[model samples]
Target: MMRSAALCMALCLAMSMAACQPGPAAPPQSAPTSSVAGPPADSAGGATSPAVTSPEPPAPAAPPALSAEAQAQLDQELVAAAKANNVPLVSELIGRGGNVNAKDAIQDSAFLYAGAEGFNEVLRLTLAAGADVASTNRYGGTALIPASEHGHVETVQILIAAGVPVNHVNNLGWTAMQEAILLNSGGPRQQEVVRLLLAAGADPGIRDPEGRTALQNAERLGFAEIAALLRGHG
Candidate 1:
């Protein structure tokens, strides 16, 4: 009886001890949240920053080279040199392959100035360099016609010998023969130019714009010898 009573008392004491102990308390709550500065997230509602771009610099402009057209224009120095009566320069240009027949803006060839100005060497050089003997200026005046008009007897002979068309009537309806008699002073030199043109077979019968033949013009201009020469041919 004593043993059974002792076991029952131990069990009651164990139960009382378990009930008397306190239950575990609830878990502690965390503090309010805070955000830290860091790389932005895609899911965030905030607007994204725009990307920056650097512009490229422009390329440098290049210097231009002389073109063929420009070279041709600059080569017209030959024509200008002729007009300026620069014989040495003209000869130099000719020796350097400058275009002997090169024309100006007005279509005046180098041969015209050389003949008109009585630049004998220039004329010879231009002719030898292949300048057109029969080429006319803008006025329809050949080198021979102007040489005749200017009473340049030597130049007239030179041009005539070079095969310039003698009876070529210009826009003014005048041949070299008529110009030698009518437009020039009735001096001995002018008379000699007329004789040369006549010898070259210049058509003495060709009339001027005024319906006057070279014979009539010579007679009226008081060139008795020139008139007599024309009458002899007629």
Candidate 2:
């Protein structure tokens, strides 16, 4: 009986010690993993992951197909605009590819007709836009010839200063000075124009088919002042 009680007391002490001791920790589990391998990249929205961006499209080119009707309308407007001395409209047309030196059915470019009609502003504008100052009409009469023929001294002076040939003979074998002498229009400036042409190196002795010099034409037409001016230059 003593041995049995001793054995029971020893077994009860063993059970109490086992209950107080700490157990081995379960195997450490790996941290929750992400589906992707690397860290996320930054985005435009200030977010960790960014979206792909697309490229922008290019601009379209202007059209170049000009219709016949449109061209006719533009031509009419350009002619009228030139006649009216509408510098702004003329410049606009020229800027939009309109021809500043285009000739009409009468074989007159805008500049030629403008100079012929004494459109001084139009002449200047056309010249500034690259109009041919030396362009001749179908009759082979240049701007300077007509201007001088009509006794338009200012226009003639402009043409002369613009580098026009002062002695250009038209198809009728008449120089500007000869035309001035032959014409009986008797404008307010005929004598002055005759004198100007003579001063600008016009040969007073040049004869036409009738063998009449500019001085002879003046003499026949009774332009005493023009004749005197030519004689003085001679």
Candidate 3:
């Protein structure tokens, strides 16, 4: 009976010891870690760590089609300034990309208007702005023709000195020389013009549409001094 009791006690003690012992050392704990696959998320809701980016493309260029209304407005500004003989305004307009050789509705360019109106300063401006010396009016006359007919001696001198084709005949078959004689009397002013034109290599023999020479036109207009000048050339 004692042996039976002792065996029962021993079995109970072994069971208690096994229960208190740690089970299989609980499989060693592992530390938390990160991967190198990609950037980590930002806590502040901003860009991620090792942030990635790309270059932005350049802006587009301006279009080339000119609007009709804009073109008309530019033309109006240029014409008004030129016709008003506002040298500073005209220069300003030209500097702002205004067409120096732009023709008016009547086909008269700024240089033509300036020369015809005896606006010598404006004439100089337009010329320096690359105005074509041969730009014509509706009547097919150059700047020289009207200036000659109006006896603008200084304007004529300027035109000739600027390398205008002194012998150029218009569609009307009129040379500046003929206009200087037939359109106006070859008086002292016209006489000075003739001298200037002749000195610049004007062809006195060039005829008008009526086939009249400058000397003949001078004679018909009773411009004795002009006729004598032409005779000396002949």
Candidate 4:
């Protein structure tokens, strides 16, 4: 009976030792995870930095405005340059904001002076600089009238091509064709000027203040070439 009792005690002690031992270690305790996301990877599997945007460039500044007196001085200088046929100076002045059609005290703008005086270089500059093509002079005539009267053949051509009125009559009731016939010496230049006028749609039948046609004026002035041209056009 004692043997049996000692055997029972040994079995109880073994069970108590097994229960005191730790259970599996508990799984190590995983570290806390962050909520922030990492940068996306490129096709090559390398870390890509965040994209940085560049700022827009500033706009260009506006040109400075000129005062009234300064503008008038610039216009005066341009007129003087045109009158002298100084092409370079005229170009410079025009670039500096000189008004190409600004008239002086005598109603003669740079364009008027250049066209009337046959200053072809200055005339071209003024034209390119936006000269008023239909602007009149002191005599209330277009640039074409004086150009025709002065026997400037090339000048006549230029004015006509620039859209000057072909039949524009001056305050004196004279057309370009009439002035070319009455005021000129019936020369080759005058004859050519008449031809250009007729070709550009100048009406030879338009009467003057004296109630005479361009043909009659040519006939009265004995301009055979001009008379022939007027008759042919009619």
Ranking by TM-score: 4, 3, 1, 2
Ranking by lDDT: 4, 1, 3, 2
Per-residue lDDT tens digits for candidate 3, residues 1-234, read 999999999999999999997777567679867665555557986658674688888876544445777666665677678789898998877766666677777886778889888999889988998989877888888888888888999999888888777777777788888888887766799998898888888999888888888888888878999999999988
| Model 4: lowest-lDDT 10 consecutive positions | 56-65
Tell me the TM-score of model 2: 0.64
Candidate 1, residues 1-234, lDDT tens digits: the string is 999999999999999999999999989999967776654656676656667888888885543454777646644888888888888898877665677787888887778888987988888888898778889988888988889888898899899999999999898898888888777787888888888888888889899988988888888878888888778877
Per-model C-alpha RMSD: 19.6, 10.1, 11.4, 6.1
Model 4 misplaced regions, further than 4 Å? 1-63
Per-residue accuracy of model 2 over 22-95 as CA lDDT, tens digit each: 99999999999888766454565443755678878876553355687776566556667887878788777755
Better of 2 and 3 by TM-score: 3
The local lDDT score (0 to 100) that residue 130 gets in candidate 1 is: 79
Q: Write down the lDDT that model 2 would get.
A: 0.76
Which ten-residue region of model 3 has the weakest summed lDDT? 32-41
TM-score, every prediction: 0.68, 0.64, 0.68, 0.73
CA lDDT, every model vs. true structure: 0.83, 0.76, 0.83, 0.91
lDDT for 58 (candidate 4):
88
